[model samples]
Target: MRTTTRMLALFAVPALTVTGCGLFTDETTEKMTDVANSFADALNADDPAAAGAVTTDPPRAADTIGTLYEGLGKDAHFEVTGVDKDAGTFTLDATWKFGKDGHNEWKYTTTGKVDDTGDGWKVGWDAATVAPGLDAGPLTYSAVYPEASRVLASDGELMTQQVVTVVNVSPGADLAAVANLIGPISPGITAPSLQSDLTAVQGKPITAITLRETDIAPIETQLAALANVTLSPQTRLLTVEKELASPTLAGLAQLWQSDADAAAGWAVRAQTAQGTQRLAGRDPEPTTDIRTTLDLGWQRAAESALAPITQPATIVAIAPSTGNVVAMAQNSAADTQGPIALTGLYPPGSTFKTVTVSAALQAGTVTPDSIVACPGSANIEGRVIPNDNNFELGNVPLHTAFARSCNTTMGRLAVDLPPEALTDAAAQLGLGIDYVTPGLTTVTGSVPAADTPALRVEEGIGQGKVTASPFGMAMVAASLAHGSAPNPTLVAGQPGTPDRTPPALPATIADQVKTMMRETITDGTATQIRDIPGLLGKTGTAEFIDDTHAHGWFVGISGDLAFAVFVHDANSSGPAVEAAGRMLRAR
Candidate 1:
């Protein structure tokens, strides 16, 4: 009887144990799921402290957790895969997304343990599980960039090389003392502003400015002694003539980055003393130099011509045959107003007579030999038009009128064409056309279509609704020189596009316009450059706000180069023509 009862008890025990296993499994699964969810919430929130709460060593876990997210600038989370109650462990997959677009991601499997510490079940966290294959050590992030390359000119001259210096300022013990120390080195340094900027943040340093190594060498030791100043010297590609080519050089750098993006010239990596891992992408290949269409000699000539100007001035040169930008220079005085040479909109004055003359010849309204009356001034439809200083040449040949930049004659010629003819002609010359390219910022001059006779008269003389930049006027000369509208290019492979293609002017018309321009040098307003051979040009004194202040302009072609010189508030065209002469002679 006792044996049978013992056997029956054993059978009953097996059934009870099987039933208990289901209950325990359900409870363990729920608890482990909750732990995984809590862990993911902390990581996604970038709350390192909260994430560390579930780990064995809170401080160590907190540091590693913070390092992983902060260094990479990423949002991380995890999804539970399975839980093994018998082994007291759980499996999960961690995911991290980086960058503004969130297109980059890192996903990996990791394991955590369920530990009981008096109150309830807890997760055992490890840094290695946060980022797959991470070892026990400090994690550091770095972006490795390839060595900066050179920028070369079309003629194979080096335009830029790798070298630069960075300057910084910080809050120090004595603001006035530091300012006094730096005042002689940086003439513009002010105590109040320096103090304010340095104290803007409690413990942060500020970058005051960047200068060439040669510029700062004289005061390098003195600056180093200052508690508030810091100097960091770096080697990066910079233009040889920093001021002359700064704007274009910056644009070229951007263009190079775009090309380098595909080749992976940069990498964001996570590294430890033990090993390094590429977090985002592979490293780049060795860098190569970039070639541009700039002519270094021409650029220097333009720079020298504008450097001594006390007032705002600009000079631009282009290769007429290829439409390549050979040189662009703006004096420091003009730089205060921004890149006005390329982007400033101003009346073209008589320099625009090129457009008017082109239209008149194209429409057969006038010939170079045709007789035109150039009075001192004339009233047309209630609007008055006059030559410079009201000068007059009565009944001269059209070529003579154009050579002298007779505004009255240009106005009279405008009356003969269709009201929109000047605008169309300017369009044909590449004005009013937007140039879209990488790193090139330009304002395509505007030529408003005239609906009234008075407006047409004003447009003819390059006033009223007609406006242009040195770049635009240079293109006008280039069109005549090249026989077609040249698409100006800076970078070798990147050429700018116009708004639309324009009809080609008749060869005879272009040739006649060129002849008239040559006359300006030999027998007209631009005789200042008459000694310079093979030069064709025009001079302009654009009246601004009642003629007390006038902008001087000169647009011309010398050899294979077409260019424009502009002097703000010059009151006469002599300065611009003189500048052109100096630059052309230098070239």
Candidate 2:
């Protein structure tokens, strides 16, 4: 009776579970879990086709999964959480990473069904299997970038986003009509030039030019009316004043765009019959404003000073007390030579006398009151050094010779100093030193060691092998005004990093140099426009190609401002001095 009862119990258990849980034996349960895991493995591998092959319907599943994966930034990942054989379902954890660096993530748990379907176990094919309510519509990922931040100067905004019209000419468009309509407002856009440009591009749509809103408003309608002409209004970072143009603006705009991109918000969404619904991602944060050390008033003054000059000219001004770049202005002629204001190298000429004198004083070669011979021309170690127009001062105080820009005296003084004296002094005054300044690429003047007396004489007079940019000369003047070289800066909060820290310029030495510069304005070569109050300057005439032609330079200090003016091929220091006067008076 016991054996018969046990046998009956086993049969009864199998009969009761046969239609439901009973059908899924250990083997069947393992197979189901295997199928689910295989599907997850394929998805994690980013192989949509392989993942779908394990599903009940391959083609439909592959296509749907591919679309969803791409829409989710193509960085999707999947994990099989659990498998419920009784319910013929499996749980999956889905994670999608977004953005250029995949720093953003959207994770969720989804459920899918698995069935034998009279063959082997396979995941049920459905868009819902990939995501909850995903069958509603197509999936998409998008980024909502915050508005570009404004570039602010010391006083106010220097650059802001504004609408600009882009003029595009399509294939077979009437080039003549486009040129005639655009040429008047846009410089350098003519019919023949447009034809040549279009032809070179294989008749593709040519983006002729981008015009500011004010410049394009009048002709917007006319341009749109022309066939194959597309006038697209786009947002661009532009200067507040239309006439305000500078190479610095381009760097500022790049920084602005980078800031905006970094603050961008991302969203994983779907377009459904009901409407667009966001699946994941956070709202974009507001972009921070970009602040520069530039002072708009000073910039305008510098620009105005160089406006009438046809030669390549620039003005670089710095706040001596803070080492902040207050203004940088370049004329159209200077613009053609690139950002020469900051990077172009030219012989600093007599401007370099400042360094020579400083080195002489530091080396104990001469005192400000010491009498020195300022011959019209002097031969030192086979090098002939001459003052401008061979001007001679038989014997005078060192300060008087400096004010007069007596090259002969400076040369003799330099020849008496150590080889590295001038190089060290120039570094102390910020030249001959590399500064990694933010928002500006600069080549400060280079003062190599004058290892020989001839070279020293040449360098003393700011001649051979000595080169400086306008920006560099400004720093030299700033060093004297501030009693030490300040760490130059462009963007606020970002001070420059010098490659090497030089010894500080002594206060006494700086004071003596400043005195000489003041005398230059009061009683020397720069006396022409010395009427401007509290001005201290040094005038320079640097020979380039030959003695007949030279670049003019003036490095000066006025109140708290220190500036350098450079005029390419100006023949003498007169133009630079004149420009400096105009800049100072305007301030």
Candidate 3:
């Protein structure tokens, strides 16, 4: 009986020992799993320092984890999975997003080991645990661009090309000499700025402005001869013709920047001693040509017509049927005023008589042939209004009065309508509304309330609180030709659709106004330009002040083309009329 009892006790000892070993193993695994889960929480929250606290090498772990985050373009996160505490190991899954959009995520798995510290469990730090193969080295981001696309005209003629010429100045170079050499080639190159750039480089060469290929040609020889200057050429987008430097083309050039940048591909890579490995992103898609509605021939002709005019002048030509702006040109004198053709705010002068006639006819105040009195001058609301040069043809038909630009007669006619009549008519003719089109900017003109007889008299003659851009006047002529206002467009695919639909001009009113404009060209204010076949126009000498010089203006329509020309500070409308004749003849 004593021997059997001793055997039972021996068996009980082995069972107790086995149970103790199992409990120790289970407790160790739970502690290791807790550490692994805490580290992963820190990494997921983008707190590498916190993650490092649970690692054997805290500082090294933090640095490695931080580098992995940055090397992945700062778009990375991790998860802890498949924890095996008995083996002191855990599987780490890392995700990296490198594209502009966060949709592209490169995911891979790595292994992290846990160790039993004196008091608690801690992770064994390794760069590979942050990202697979990151233990080798760091990563970098770069952009590789394809050949830029060219801008083309309606007839497939090349309008612009991408050209880059780097103007490099050596350290301590003579900036004044540099400016003198390059200033004539390009404006806005200042000596002080050039010197500042050179000084910032600290003996290294500094790149000056990147110019167009054609622009660089004239100064290439001079630049090469400079002792401390170097000219390096790279392809960049630019206008082909210097004359196309007008704002219309400049706007088009500005729009091409996005497409060019998109064609340049982006990549994040890891460059190690062994080789470079592409980590994320892809090459840019192939490019496509951008087509515009500009007619090069008409653009050149308009430029030629405005070339001879020394004063500030602008001309805009559009196809009345399609509302396609084919030509726009501004002389250097006008360019100083800044895109005046599309944005200049000036009184339409007698050109706005077109609106008056439309308003009168729409309101049933008069027909094209209704007889109206045209006196030398008339008093209305204590103000005197007269025709151009104060000469009047007395007692004429409404068409004759309009063609002659009889200010007093038109003033009388406008007084019969409500204050909103002229403004409402202007809106129907596509004025007073902004066009929200890509790459095209405009300041559509305005018409203020004519609450008093004095204001009405002035507004009738296009004098007081009424204004129109060259673009707006062209739309007026286009409205007459189209029997309604047509939405003008610059780009082929992106037509400028108005936010609110404009009311259509009545067909009868448009017809009568067209007749008045035709008669004006044939025998009235614009008779000087009547030689051009189908020419219909209105001449304007808008008085800016009581004693100062007036602005010259003309809005004309010939065949498919409708145009507006402006000459600032002209003593008479003759200059604008002559410009119109030259442009129409060229057309």
Candidate 4:
């Protein structure tokens, strides 16, 4: 009887054990799922503390989670894609976005563990839970920039990437020693000025100067030996030729920065104890070069021609066939007054005779061969007009009068025309037209309508209300050469759009004006530069402030090239003509 009773008890023990095991497995599965759901919810909400609350090591987990989230940027998200309750783990889909507009995305799946360690079910804290294969270290998001592009000219690079050495002065350094060592090499940095700048920014290092590699090579060792001086090598965009400096470079740099930014790539990396680990992101795209219409040869020639002139001077050249600005150069004195070659307004003086002749030919008022009177001085409607130095060309053909720049003759013809005649003619020659050009800013010039004969006489001679930039005068020459006003351009593939398209000048009228311009170079005011072959030009000595001071101008066209030369306060047109000759000879 005792053996039979023991056997039954053993059988009952096996049945109870089976049922208890099933119940325990079900409860653990439910608890594990609950913990997984809580952890995913906390991460989705970007609540690091809440996420850590469902983990085993709360403090450590919270700190790491917070750091990783911040590093991934503001738009990181996590979701529990799947859960394996039997294995005590969950699958999480993680996504991070980066970039200025958050257009870049990084998506991946990671596995996180859940376990019951005698207390309760909790998520097991691990770096892998945040990002797959990540080590226990700070995560970082960084921008990977593309290689800087160059500003290209017609023949070669105008601006290129170069390494520059930055000279920095730390606080409490020997200011006088630094100044003495670097002052001569770097302009505008003196001992007193360094002290003032240092004091302004308390406890911060002052950058004494930035120098190109060639500029700093000889002085590098000397600067490095000094106390509190640091030489940091950094890459920068600078002109290929040191002498090639222009305000236009600033605009090109801005455009280069935009291109670099657009091609920039990004990465989410972990700064681990071993090394940097790139988790996600794409590599930067190759940067494309920026093309400009500048011709290196023309630029160099223009610069050299103006270098000797002590006074303010400039030269602007364009291609008649394309209207592309080939060269824009100014001397040091002219630079001080700003980009005057492109925007500063001065009376065109006798250069306006081109417009007058074109207007007369269009109006049938006079043919190129029509005889006209050109006295040294003439009174028309109570206003006195005279030629340069009051030189007379009495009763000559109209073409001869124009070639000689007979101001009285032009004035007489303008006084009989309609008020808007000069204005209309100026537009036809691209003088008064407004253009919206990319990568360049310019003002053509203005020709206000003259209602009275007195004003008309002045307007006809490029005086009174008429004003033109050197750039505008260049366009006038280009118009005569091209038979129509060409739209000006500075950057390749970017042409200026005129505010209003004027009617094209008649081919016959253009030819007539061209003939007169050639005569001006051969037998008229611009004969000083007559040796240049195929040259057609006009010279002017514009009186400003007083008769003793005048701005000299020479606008001309030779083959496909049209240019304007301006010599400020030259007192006569001789300097302008000489400079123009030098520039043309150089070409």
Query: Candidate 3 residues 477-524, lDDT tens each?
Result: 888888877888887777787756667898888877878889989999
lDDT of 1: 0.80
lDDT of 3: 0.82
Per-residue error (Å), model 1, residue 555: 0.2
Can you write out model 1's per-residue Cα lDDT over 1-587, one digit (the tens) per residue?
99999999999999999999988889888887787677777877889889888777778788888776666665666777887878887888876664435544566787878776656766776676676545445444443456656678887655554555576887663557656655765777777867677678765887765667777777678777877677898866566755555346667877766555444433345575657766544465666777888888888888888876778999988899898998888888888898888898889999999999998998887789999999999987778886777899999999999998888899888977897788888878888877875457887699988888888898999888899998888888888898878988987877888778888867888889999999999999988789999899999888788867889999999889999999999888988998888898885
Q: Assess each prediction's global lDDT (C-alpha) against the native.
A: 0.80, 0.89, 0.82, 0.88
Residue 365 alpha-carbon offset, candidate 2, angstroms: 1.9
Task: Sort all candidates by lDDT, best to worst.
Answer: 2, 4, 3, 1
What are the clash counts of all predictions, listed in order? 0, 0, 3, 0
Residue ranges of candidate 4 with Cα displaced over 4 Å: 1-97, 107-136, 139-149, 199-203, 375-394, 436-438, 448-455, 489-500, 542-550, 569-571
Q: Rank candidates, TM-score, best first.
A: 1, 2, 3, 4
Residue 204 lDDT (model 3)? 82
Report the Cα lDDT for residue 581, model 4: 85
Poorest 10 consecutive residues by lDDT, candidate 3: 155-164
lDDT of 2 by residue, 1-587 (tens): 99999999999987887856655477777888999999999988888899899999999889888888767756878888898878989999988888778888888998999999887889988888887657877788888888678899999989999999889888878888888888887759898898888899997888999999888988888889999999888988999999998768877787888888789998878889989988777888998888999999999999999998999999999999999999999999999999999899999999898998899898887899999998999888888887888999899999999999998899889888888998999999999888988788888989989898889989998887999999999999999999888999889999899999899899999999999999999999999987998899999999988577899999999988999999999999888899888888886
421 in model 4: Cα distance from truth in Å?
Answer: 2.5
Winner on lDDT between 2 and 3 is 2
| Model 1 regions more than 4 Å off | 1-13, 58-60, 99-104, 133-135, 156-163, 173-185, 190-193, 196-205, 215-221, 265-281
* Candidate 3 vs. true structure, TM-score: 0.81
Q: For residues 1-587, what per-residue lDDT tens digits would candidate 4 score against the true structure?
A: 99999999999999999999999988987887789889988988889899999999999888888888777765877788777877788888978888877888888888889998777888998878878655556878888888888899988999999999999999888888888878887667888899999999996998999999888988899889988999999999999998896656766787888788889898877787788888778899999899999999989888888988999999999999999989989999999999898898999888888999899899998999999999999998898987777899789999899888888999999999899999999999999998887766889899999988889988998888999999999999999899999999888998999999899999999999999999999998888778889899988878888666889989999899999999999887788888888887897
